[model samples]
Structure formats: C-alpha cells, structure tokens
Target: MSIIKKLASQTAIYGLSSIFGRFLNYLLVPLYTYHFSAAEYGVVSEFYAYAGFFAVLLVFGFETGYFRFRDKNDPQRDSAYSTALWFVLGANLVFLLLIRLVRTPLSEALHYAHHPEYVEWFAIILGLDAIASIPFARLRAENKAFRFAGIKILEILVTVGLSLFFIAYCPPLYAKNEQVWFAPIYDPGIGLGYVFIANLAASGVKFVLLTPQLKGLIWGFDRVLFRKMVGYSLPMVVIGFAGIVNEMLDRALLKYLLPHDPLMNMRMLGIYSACYKLSILMSLFIQAFRYAAEPFFFAYADKSDARRVYADVMKYFVIFCMAIFLLVTLYIDFFQYFIGREFRAGLGVTPILLLANLFLGIYVNLSIWYKLTDRTLMGAFVSLGGALITIGLNLWWIPHYGYVGSAWATLACYAAMAVVSYLLGRRYYPVAYDLKRIAFYIAFGLGLYFAREPLLTYGYRSWQAGTLLMGSYLLSAALFEFRGLFHFRKKLPAGDSGKSLGPGRK
Candidate 1:
C-alpha cells in the first residue's frame, strides 16, 4: 500500500506538471485557430502528424530499452545507458542528414515545396527531442520526479512564450511600424512557420538542459550490450510506429482521402485537428502516467502483490479517464470556446476522440504485460493489427463521412487494441483485472452523458443538468469504492513505509 502511495505521489507530480504544462500549450490552440484559417493550420497539423512517426523512428525505443537493461547496481548499468544513448545520438544524426538531403524533393512531395525549410526545422526538432528521451527516461528510472517535471514545464514555457511573442506580439508591432529592434527577427511571411520555430527553439532548450545526462556517453558503448538492447527494442520500434499509425494516421490521411479539393480537404483536416485538442486532458494524463508508471512497474515487478497493484491502477485509471470524458463532453458548451469559430464545426467528434484516448490509455496500462514478460514481439503484432484497422477504416470512411469518419475510426482502432492486448495479457502474464467494475464505470459515464440530452427536457439548463450528472457519478463511485480502498490500506503489513524502490533497491 505504501508503494502504491509513492506511485501515486510520483504520478501526481508528473500528472500535475503535465496537465499544467500541456494546458499552457493548449492555450495556443485558440491562438492558432483564431489567427490562421483552417487551411493554413492544416499544414501545421500535417507536419506534426509526420513528426510523430519520426519521433518514434529516431529513438528506436531505446528509452525503454535502457530502462530494461540498466537495472539498479548492475555492473553493466552505465554501459547500457551509454550504449543506448550513443546509438540514439548516432541514429538521429544520420536521420537528420537524410532529411537534409531529401528536404527539397520531400517537401515537394508533401506539397510544401515553397518552404522546404519546414522540413529542415522539423528534422532538427525531432532529432533533438529523440536524443533527450533517454535522459527523461533516466529521470523516471531514478524517481527524480520533481526535476523531470520542472524541466518539462520549462520546455513548455519556452514554447508557449516564444509562440506568443512570434504569433501574437510581433506581427501587430511590425505592422504598426513599432518595436523596430524586433523587426529584423519578425517575418510576417513565416506566418504558421512561427509555430514550428517556437517548438524547435523549445526542443533546443530542453536538449541543452539535458546535457548533464549525457555524461553517460563518456563510459563508451559496449558491443554486447548494444546488440542485446537493440534486439529487445527493435520490436518496440515496430510497436511504436504502429501506435503512431493508430493515433496520427487519421490526420495524415484525411487530406488525401477526403474526396474534396485540396484546399477544402486541408480545411476539414484543420477543423478536425483543432477539435482533437479537446482530448488533451486524456492524452496528457496518459502521458504523465506512462512516465511514472513504466518505471514503477519495472521496479515493483518482483513484489508479491504487484499484479493486484496493476489491477487497482487500471481501475482507477479508468475512473479518472471516464471523469475526463464526462468533463469534456458534458461541459462541451464551455470547452468549445477554446477553439475559434471555424473549428467548432468538428466539435461533434470530441466525445468520440476522447473515448478513443481513454481506450488508448487502457491499452497503455495493459501493455505492461508484454513489456514485463519479454513478449514485445506479441505487442508489436497487436499494435500492427490496430494500425491496419485504422488505415482500412480511414480509407473507407473518410470518403463517406469526412472528418467524422476519422473520429470513429480512431475510437475503433483504440478499442480494438485494448481488447486484443487484454486478451493476450491474460494468456502470457495474467492480472485479474476488475473487468466488471471497469465496465460499469464506463457504461455509467456514458449513460450520464446520454442522459444529459434527455434530462434537458425537464427544463434544466445545460450547465445545471451537467453539474447534477457529474455529481451523481462522483457520488456513486465514492460509495462503491471507498470501503474497498480503505480495506486495502488497512491490510498493509506493519512497518511498511512504502517508499519507492530507489536506485539500488530494485
């Protein structure tokens, strides 16, 4: 129980920082949507969709590989770290060179021929970020939650501050012939390019701050360790690329398959992308949980009650995700204002995408089975299957249903992945997950959401009805789980302080 408490604390630190940082970044959604047309913003969205693939590709899953190999106090720990770090650094260097060589033709192929610089900037951004992942992973391994959160927040601040300076401040000043000193740096022609520049600068700042973690590089790479880590992590790369396909392929494919003119397709993509931001809370929580939970799981793997802890974690994760789903869907009237008017047309997809993200979070939790059991190849198979589902559905649906089709496709992909992962997990590394309670929470949340419209017939305002439904759900959850939570806590063995399995303990 103490271990669970520590995990919660780490998760809280990571989760709160992520929520705040991403919320700050989330503010930029309104800025972009308001300032740029849907067509213009779609270019930014498309580039980022491609970035997701390379982000996975360049790192080659070495972050998790390092965690797997660098166990506490192992003689080869430093070797594992250095080998993984050097390998990633070398790979990214080659990746950047390739991007440079192909930037022109690649930009032309992507329909951004006039601004091949976009390709160049993103290559550097992704390379820097991939290099930094190992250090971030090391932080998780070490349980340095505060430092990790601080650095993450700092990066977000840099990105958000620079974005505001370039997009919001500079253009108005340049137009009025004011701030002449800043004039030389500001380029109105850059337009949406400013967003990418802000992100690139942020990645650079994060990379610089992580230089201390690069000290491991001096240990030199080990051929044996490098080969082993690569063997383990290659499947992770496949899993990651497939995961990207599941998450981003819709945005990537929308423009090509929309059955509309190029510009209109971009317009629809922009609207869909903007509304997708409404799922930020779900995505951000999952990300923060992943940061904390991955290390926690590895560290706690030998514990007698680890499976129980994992099951509890899954239930609570579902509860919280359902809460986020309802929070966004029920109060959508307020959340809709977060994007500009043009993007509001795609708001109907918000609940679908949010639920999809919820399922993705579940899959992320369930995936620990394969990671722990060294069955990553099986994980790859599941993710690849989901990716294929996403591709086929988007190809068939986008032509008929437009962006809404993409939304449903995402939900279908994630839900299918979660189910498949869960079934496979039971076979290889069973955790008696509380499926009934999990299902109840999900069904209850959805029931409340659907009940909202019917309840409005009673003359209650949307806000009032939403508040009442949310309150009811909270009360039911508390009533059902309070006793179980307390019982678990009471059963903790005497003298168990529940501190983290620190550096050498694991």
Candidate 2:
C-alpha cells in the first residue's frame, strides 16, 4: 500500500479506539458535571494532570526506546525487550516505595492531606501503566493494530462501567440498601476517588491484555543492550518530561497560584478540563496520525525521496487538522452540550486550545527530522523551550485571566515550538514542506470560523452555519485539488510506470 493508504487504514483502527473510547469516556464529563460540583471535578482534573507528569517519569521514555532499537537487525531483539521491561519495572518498584514512604508529606504538599489514598492509589495506577508501556510499544512494533485497538477499547469500557457503577448507581443503591457490595468503598463525598479507582481497574485490565506479549520472552537482562537502550532513551526521558510539563504544568500550577480554597479553585479547573474535552476532536486525529506516521517515517527514512514524502505528509496533515479544527469550532454549539450546561461557560477556551493542539501536531511532524537523524537531544531542547514558554505564560497570565490564561499559554507555547522546530529542521534536515499552501488553508479556515456569526445572523442555526462553513472549505479544496483527489487510480504513462505525479501536481 502507499503511505497514505496505509496511514488511513492504521488511523481508522487507532481512531476507532481513540475516538470512540474518548467519546465513551466523555460520558463521564456530564456524569461528573451533574453529580459533583465544578470544584470537585477540578480536583479530578488537577490530579490527573499531575498523573500525566508522573506517567512520563515512571516510563522513562522506554516506549520510544523500544521503537528505536526494535528497528535494528540486532541478534538481541528479545534481550533488548527484556532489558527495557526490567529497567522500567525496577524503576517503578522504587518509585512506588518512595511514594509510599512520602505519602504523608506528598499529600500535605498537594493539599490533599485528608485524602492521601488519592496519592497512593494514583501512584499504583501510574506504576502499572508505566510497566505496561513496554508491551504496548511492542504491539506497535509488531503491527498488532487490532489487538492494540481491542485492548484500548476494553480498558475504556471497563473504566466507564466502573465509573458509572460508583458515581451514578452505587450511591443510591447504598442509601436504599446498605447490604450492597462495594458500598463502603463508594464514598460519594470523595468525588475524585472514584476516578482514581476506575483508572486503577482499567490499568489492571491493560496489564492482563498484554499478558500474551509478555509470555515466551526471555526475562534475562542483557547489561550491554540495556546500557545502549538507556543511552538512547535517557534523552527521551528529558524530552518526555518537558513535553508533558508543557501540556500539563498549567493545570498543576493553577492550584498553587489560585486562591486557597481547594474546592473553588478545583471547580474552576474542572470547567477548564471539561471544555477541553471538546478540543480532543482535533487532538484525537493528531494522535492517530502520529501513531501511524512515526513508524512509517522511521521505516522509510532511507528512501531517496523520503524528504519529499515528509514534506507531503506535513501538508496533508495540516490540511486535515485544520479541517478538524474548523469542524469542531464551527459546530461547538452542538458539541459543548457533551459537558453539562454549567460547564459550558468555559467553552470560550475551546478555540484557543484547539489551535494549540494544531500547533502541537505540526511540531510533532517537524520533530521527526531530529528523531530520524538521531539528534534527539534537539527534540529535548525544543520541548524544553516549549515547557519554559508554557510555565512563563501561565505564571504571567493565569493570575489575571484564569482558565483563559491556561488556554493562551497552551497556544503560545505550541506556536513557539512549531516555529522553532521548523526553523531548526531546515538547518539540520530540510524538507520542502508546502508552507504557502498550508498557510492558505489555515487562513481560509480561520476566515470561515469568524464569518460564522455573521452567517448565523441571517436565520441560519449554528449547526447549519457550521455545515455551510465546512462544506465551503471542502468544495474549495476539491476545486483546487480535483486532480489529486480523482487521479488516485490513474495509471502512469506506458514508459514511466516507476515515476508518478507528486502532491499538488497535475
């Protein structure tokens, strides 16, 4: 298959798990919004934000390490796998013990001293997830997309079921019948505790699903290969830490910078998070694209025309991502209802956050140059720049603008990284990306987005306005690129079968 077709297939499978899984998980937004106060949900959001950081720490970038080493025709593939597994397992064990020892102090530090179990159980969840990362990466390396999708979907299902049972059904059942099982553990007052427990259950299920990947493997650790993988992966640890901090530090810092009232501050955070879910429509596409693109890029890195392919991929990526951005933003009037009515007030941040994700996707594509060239330290530097931008912006703006500041921080940080990566990639490994064409698409999308309000004033409902905006963009693209769309099955000339038309070529 061609790269585009292969990407489409993999993206469909991965998107099934991600889009549907997130949709199912999104049900929790409304569930929590209705059941718990905004502040309570904020606690859940803030805690998970911190969990994101710890997750990167515990895994220590071995997932990417697996991808990097698995590509080599080493005699010690099994040994490499086993070594990476044991390394993460050892780190997770030590981290768990340390968390246990410092549980009190950590709880006190986070202002969750009254609910230290949140810290404890969260540590367990992150530890299990970290250990599970090895087998998960192996699945990707081995091309087990179906199994990957199944396991992911199953995990989401289990999490949703448990969450509903605890938060929605259990309380009333306990009130009506004290003999009900699991009632004591289902404390309604501990709003965020249920979220943690659900995550723990889901992570456990993931471990079980990965049992097949773990079996029949040599558990013996190879110190030499271990050292090599660690050398390759350690930089990634810094990159991953910085990358996650860029994404999450705003939420974590919000609690500290905001007022002392945990409940009130968390409520504000919850609103931000709930609306943020709406932005995931764009993010999910970017994630699925990355899942397929990374492996494909690395596999094709040696092709003579790989640079052209990379450039084409970036153009198409921006086109589709911008389309998604427009779709979500134009029709947010409908999607915002996914969260509760009370939380809809934060919908103002959706466009800003969506643009941030778009920039983030672009940066990911740009960073591939560094990854392929083995100059991953450059990636660390880029992400560190982004992290600094995120922190600096949050500190300056969150105090004045609240969650809106978080939105701006995300946008500014990602835009800076995207610009920097493009500049640096040109210096290190240039690809002729269609910056002019991509900018036209973005400008067109933004113009359509802003014109929606005027269109709606003419008796068009929001959904109708959205449909027209999306349809216009599609029609314009089709008109301008009709040959590219229609010539998919066109045969090459009789004497030139090996040569084919390039992107945007007639």
- Which parts of model 1 are misplaced by more than 4 Å? 74-77, 486-506
Q: Model 2 lDDT vs. the true structure?
A: 0.83
**Residue 485 in candidate 2, Cα distance off native in Å:** 5.8
Highest-scoring model, TM-score: 1
| Tens digit of per-residue lDDT, candidate 2, span 1-506 | 27667767887788878899888888888888888888888888888899988889898778888777773565335676777888888899999999999999999988878999999999999999898888887777766878888898899999999999888888888889888888657676765688888989999999988887775256678888877788778788888898888888888888777655766677788888889888888888888877777777877776656776677778778888888989899988788878888799999999999999999999989987678777788788888988988888899988888889989999999999999999888877777888898899889989999999999999999889999999999888777666764663465344442223232111
lDDT of 1 by residue, 1-506 (tens): 57767878888999999999999999899999998999999999999999999999999989999889995886334788889889999999998999999999999999889999999999999999999999888888888888999999999999999999999988888888865788778888898899999999999999999999889898898998888898899999999999999889999999899999999999999999999999898998899889989988988887766777788899989998999999999999999999999999999999999999999999999998889988888899999999999999999999999999999999999999999999888777778788999999999999999999988898989899999999999999998899878886799777553333221110
Worst 10-residue lDDT window for candidate 1 reads: 497-506
Cα misplacement distance, residue 277 of candidate 2 (Å)? 1.3
